[model samples]
Target: MGSVWMYAPEIGYGARQSLVGFTVEAADGVIGHVDRQQDQPGMQHLVVDTGVWKFGRSVLIPAGAVTGIDTEAQKVRVAPSREEIKAAPRFATDSETADPGYLSGVGDYYLSLRS
Candidate 1:
């Protein structure tokens, strides 16, 4: 269990906002819809319900992975592919969401992709 470096905001960023019900689009295609979002700087994340795509499993998407959010279209664009997101650390409950160790794993996973 270890803590990874916090996300560094690139190209600046808007105020932390909710993305619930917003459709998440991967580079290839739509992945799922946002069930919840944590907009805290450095600890931001999205709780996405994969619907029928992954048998309704929910995954945690780090906020840094988000490229853009289109309020008009109600869509959130993510940089990671569907497969990457599918393989990300799962978010089964609120407790897991708050767990530093779990979050560290997620952070490590995403960070590994950039390396």
Candidate 2:
């Protein structure tokens, strides 16, 4: 299997190991702030708390979806549109992060959108 390369910095390239508490923006607008991030090489992801935007629901966004990270602004940019994210499989529980089946579903869903 191939590793899913996470966000690619538009200006240059380097490893950005953390993103907790960074606000996330979709193609159209800000979606939420990242509450947590996974550093796994193949399965990087961000756990975003939607706050009042989605009635406090949390979404797990694949790192591949991230476009850039602005450390100064404390923000992360993602490619998926707001609607696409809202339609993605929900990340409701902490344990779900370790479930291969659930992760596969999320990966498949985003992959489908790319095609």
Candidate 3:
């Protein structure tokens, strides 16, 4: 399996392109928009701001979960469903996001969904 932090090669995402403000869609439907993204090698991920969807909560989605990126439409699609994303480990603070342990837990959760 490929690293969860790296976007799948098939996604064909340009490394220099900014995904911020792009709408994010889950398998079911629209979930939110990309508020921020970490493009650093081995740490790639998107921080989605789910406005009014989950009471303004934010979720951290690893790049590997991204199934597609439509630059023309400014949209990103992930493999998970809305419920699956909502059930993911809560993204609380930047401090936690920086913690190796916390990130591992989050990564493990997403990886498990593949099975």
- Model number with the top TM-score: 3
**TM-score, structure 2 vs. true:** 0.88
Per-candidate total of colliding backbone pairs: 0, 0, 0
Q: Name model 3 segments beyond 4 Å from true.
A: none
Off by over 4 Å in 2: 1-5, 8-16
- Total backbone clashes of candidate 1, pairs 3 or more residues apart or in separate chains: 0
Q: Rank by TM-score, descending?
A: 3, 2, 1
> Each candidate: what lDDT?
0.78, 0.81, 0.93
- TM-scores for all candidates? 0.85, 0.88, 0.96
lDDT, residue 63, candidate 3: 97
Candidate 3 per-residue C-alpha lDDT over 17-79 given as tens digits, one digit per residue, 9 for 90 to 100: 999999999989999999999998898999999999999999999999999999999999999
- Model 1, span 5-113: residue lDDT tens: 3233562445555578999999999999999877665677778889999998998888777778888898988888999988887778979977889888988898787
- Per-residue error for 64 in candidate 2, Å, reads 0.3
Model 2, 19-115: lDDT tens digits are 7898999989999999988876677788999999898999998877887888889888888899999999998998998888998888888777777
Better of 2 and 3 by TM-score: 3
